[model samples]
Target: MNTTELFLVAMLIVFSIPYLIWRVFRTDYWAPLVVVQIVTGVLLGPGLLGAALPEVYGAIFTPPVIASLNGVAWWAVSLFVFLAGIELDLPLAWKSRRESAVTAGFALFTPLLAGCAAAALLLLVPGWVGPKAATWQFVLGIGMACAVTALPILILLMEKMDILRQPLGQRILRYASLDDIAIWGVLAIILLDWQRVGRQVIFLVLFALACWGLRWLMQRLAESDRWYVALVWLIVVALGADWCGLHYMVGAFLAGVALDMRWFDRDKLDQLRHHVLLVLMPVFFLSTGLRTNWTLGGATVFLAAALLLAASVGGKLLGIHLAARVQRWQPGEASLVGWLLQTKALIEIIFANVLLDKGVITSGTFTALLLMAVASTMLTVPLVTPMLKRNPGLIGRSG
Candidate 1:
């Protein structure tokens, strides 16, 4: 068949398989459709499907078809990341400064340190760190991957559980929002290219000026115009960031961050996020799957994934428990919040993809991180549901 036919066949597979599994198996209790989609992406990747059926994989995922899919995937993720940035409610976080600082700080650092130690151990083995990475870069990159909260996915799960607008849910959003800022900041540090520093500086300066003018203009435009302008702004900033060697994802986040959420209608913004996930992100997931590798052996990769999952889940809970103690939170609050905060899906995958693109982590390492992210996200709702049921009052706790 021709490239277009093959591309449609691939797209059909991407959208259909995951939806069937989610529906037929009723996996929504333990695994949401999004989580199922991610797992399916891994299973459909070269390491699994290609290894099992090389000719079929090659026939459907021809070079041109893959390129087309990648183009779609890139835009999907950029828009997703952009929406996540716009969702950040930093002012609300700052209002409860002491509590937010303590919770966000611990929630971020504990997993980070644990993941770094895990990364340090991986460095003792071969094939985990990428060829272009320095020891510190690889370690920090891996550590940060572990610490990602997938604020977008977290928002989805909270909405599913009917807590997104609850006091507890809002609190969780605050913690995740602060961590989101730090996550991107650290990514910039890791991606910093000394040779491109001047270009990056210029990009930032121009970006700042552009943001000021954009904000002024956005304030006067109708909400409808703001949406169109935001897209144009998203593309321009993303292009500039890529040119400066910081990665377009960073640019996308910055573009959204510069805009006020108040400028857009809240319901419309939510719908846009939902529509992006439904129509576009599946392509990104399939593209992500294509990048996974098990050259280090499936057992080894699974082992690494298990180790990272333990670090991410354990460290997040430990940190939140400590914060709970300090802040005198309600009895079940820390456990519930920690489990929710540890959720990682799209953001972790994006973080690993950036690391892989920059050669800070090997494809094998990316595969493991991907697996860990899937597992971490899957565990969130199941664990949090029971905790919420047993202590329903926790949902209303403001602090």
Candidate 2:
């Protein structure tokens, strides 16, 4: 087949396979369709499907097809991140700043410390650290990966669980939102290129000026017109961020945050997220899966994945439990919040991709982190359900 036809084949596989698995088996209670899509992507990657069917992988993922797929994936993630930024709810986070700050701090830092310990231990084993990484970079990068919470996936889960509009739900969003901002800040530190410091500084300065002008223009546009303008703004910011060496996603997010969330209808914004996931994000997941590797041996990757999972889960629970104690939260609240906050998917994958792109972690480490993210996310609903059932008061905080 020509590259275009082959690309369509690739697209068919990306959409059809995961959906079939999700719908056929009724995995919704345990794993959402989104999670299934991510898993399907991993299964279809070179480590598994590619190894078993090398000819198939080679043919469908030809140079041109792969390039085309990546283009779709880039835009998919760009839109997704921009939505996440628009949904940040900074005003709410600020209103509860004291509680939110304490919770976010504990939630983010504890996992970071545990993840750092796990990353350090990983160094004793070979094939986990990328060749281009400094020891500091690998350690911190892996640590931060462990600490990430997938904000988008968390929203999906909360909505499914019927807590999204609840007071407690908003509270959880506050904590996660604060941590989300910190996650990017840490990434900027990890991605800082001293030789390109001049470029990055210039980008920030110019970006600030541009944001003022952009927000001013956006404020004056009709709500309907704002939608189209936002897309243009997203692309422009992504391009500028990429050029400054900070990465396009950073720009996409900043572009969203610069504008007022009140400008967009909440329902439309939510639908946009759903549609983006349904159409374009699967390609991003497929592209993500294609990068998985097991050259260090599948068993080693599994073991490392297990260790990281323990660190991530244990640290998150510990951190939340501590905050619960301080805040004098009701019983069962800590466990529930921890399990929910531990949800990680696209954001974790994106963070790892950045690390891999920068050569801070090898494919083996990336695979392990990927596994950890999948496992952590899968555990969220099952773990939270029982607690919610037991505490009838916990369902949307008396709403």
Candidate 3:
């Protein structure tokens, strides 16, 4: 197949998936849409059908093409993160700061402790992973992977369930809002610890200055009479943060928050969401699906995959439930909150990509983590809806 044919095939998959999933089958087919997309990827790549049609497959998914796809996917993720930060109702977060603090602390530490324990256990088992170098990398990487949650997934779920207005939803959202901060801080510390002090210190100092400077500039930009200036400032802040070694999402989020003060027009956020999520995110996910490699299969891989799923879902549920209970939420509501809280969507995908790029994990491991993210999203939606409908009162009154 030539480049033209390969492009056509790529376009077909991209066009067909959304049309088949969203337009034809609608929401009823979402899970299958996800399954089909992933399975189609596996089949069309080196895994199954690709083996039978190696020439065509190789022509399509070459290294240069894959690299280009990743670049596009990264942009999509950056926008998605920015939109997430923008959508975050920081007022609500502040109102529930104590609960948010509890939830955030538990969410971060529980997984870190569990992942470290798992790493130790993995070290005990010979042949479970590769040699010492490989083992340490896998353990630390998997630990970070387990600890990460997808902020985009959680917000979408809450919106769909109409729980964003409710207390349980607010708590979860607030926790998620703070979760990103903690995640980046932990990651920065880890990255710094793993790097030379001079570079690390330079990055940290630059990041602090950038954050402070952006805050000042965004305040000024928020009052701009020209709409384009606001948008430009948003981009500048995002790009600046990206350049400073902070995630673009963090910058976008801070930009949003900075503009979110009482002076800016409330309508700006709605506009941001309209263009960002509706327009950009689907393209990103498609490109992400294209990058998945399922040919690297084995029982050990499957086992590690299961562990990641458990760590993500089970750990979040347990941590949130305990936190909710401490907040004096009833058992039913707390458990339901726990169940609802584990839905991870966008940020997890972004984090997986980051880990993969940083050499913290393999492509195959990232693929498994992505699968876990989709599964967690699907499970949380159904689990939370009944709780929302049947007992809105059960959500929580504390905060």
Candidate 4:
């Protein structure tokens, strides 16, 4: 068949297989449809599908088709990341600064240190670090990947657990919000190019001035007009960021961060998020899958994934438990909070993708990080459910 037909066929597979598995197996108890979609993307990637059925994979995912899918995926993820940035409730986090700072600081730093250690170990061997990466870049990049919490996915999980509006949930959001800001700041640092430092500096200076003007204009415009202007802003900033040597996603996030969530209707923002996920993000997931490479061997990749996951999960629990002691929280609260914060679904994937694009991590390392993210996300609900069941009062505890 032609390229368009093949692209359509690929899309059909992308949507269908994950939905069927999600629906038929009742995996929502453990793996949400989003998780299933991510897992399916890996299974369909070159390492699996290309290896298993090269002819079929090649026929469907030809160069032209892959290029088309990538165009869609880029826009999809840029928008998704932009929305995530807008969802940062910094004002609320500031209102509860001490607890949020202690938790977010510990939660972000501990895993980061652990993941850096793991990255150092990976450096002992070849094939893990990207060609262009400095030692510090690879280690810090991997460290940040391990530390990332998927704020959007965390919101979804909290809603699923029926605690999104609860006191506990609000607290978690505050912690995640602060970490989300730090995550992007660290990303910009990692993406900093000495050769293009002048360009990046100019981009930031112009961006700051433009952001102020955009905010003034947004406040005056109707909400309907704000949406249109926001898209234009997303495109322009993303272009500038990419041109200046930082990833377009960095610009996309900055674009969203410049705007206040209150500027738009809350329900409309939520609906926009939901609709973007439903319509666009699956393509991003599939495109992510297509990038997976296991050339270093499956066993090596899985071992690295296990190492990252251990560092991520273990460090998160330890950090949160320490926070619990400091904050004088009741027993089991740390475990609940830690497991929830350890979630690395969309954000980690995005982080890894940026690292991969910037040559800070190899495709092999990307595969490992992808595996780690999927495993970390899939562990959240099942583990958290039983904890909540045992201590229903935990949800009501505001601190």
Best by lDDT: 1
Q: What does the lDDT read for residue 358 in candidate 4?
A: 79
lDDT string for model 2 (1-399, tens) is 998899899999988998899999999989988898888887777778788999988888877887898899999888987887787666666777888888889999999999999999999988788878889888888888888998778877887888876777877877786787688778878777675677778888988999889888988999999999999989988998888767787788778777778999989988898899778888887777766554545587899999999999999999999998998888898888899998997789888988887889987888789889999999999989888889868755521
Candidate 1 lDDT tens digits, 209-318? 99889989999999999999999999999999888877787788888888889999999988988899889988887676665554446799899999999999998999
What tens digits encode model 3's per-residue C-alpha lDDT throughout 1-399?
665566556657655765475556555324524334443454555655466887876777776665665566566666655656555667777776787788777776677666656656655545444222355555765566567766665665566566655666666766666777666655554455443455445655665676577656656753655346545656776776666556677766666655444545567755665566555555555665555544455666566566677777677767877776777766476667667666555566666666666666555666666676677666765666666677767765545
**What is the C-alpha local distance difference test score of candidate 2?**
0.84
Q: Sorted by TM-score, highest first, which candidate order results?
A: 2, 1, 4, 3
Give Cα distance to truth, residue 376, candidate 3, Å: 2.2
Q: Write the per-residue lDDT of candidate 4 for residues 352-392, one digit (tens) a residue.
A: 87788879898889889988998999999999999999999
On the 0 to 100 scale, the lDDT of residue 336 in model 4 is: 94
Query: How many clashes in each candidate?
Result: 0, 0, 2, 0
lDDT of each: 0.87, 0.84, 0.62, 0.86
Global CA lDDT of candidate 1, please? 0.87
**Which residue pairs collide, candidate 1?**
none
Error of 1 at 304 (Å): 2.6
- Per-prediction TM-score: 0.90, 0.91, 0.80, 0.88
What RMSD does each model have against the real structure?
2.4, 2.5, 3.9, 2.8
lDDT at 91, model 2: 69
| Candidate 3 RMSD to the real structure | 3.9
In order of lDDT, best first, we have: 1, 4, 2, 3
The CA lDDT at 74 in model 2 is 93
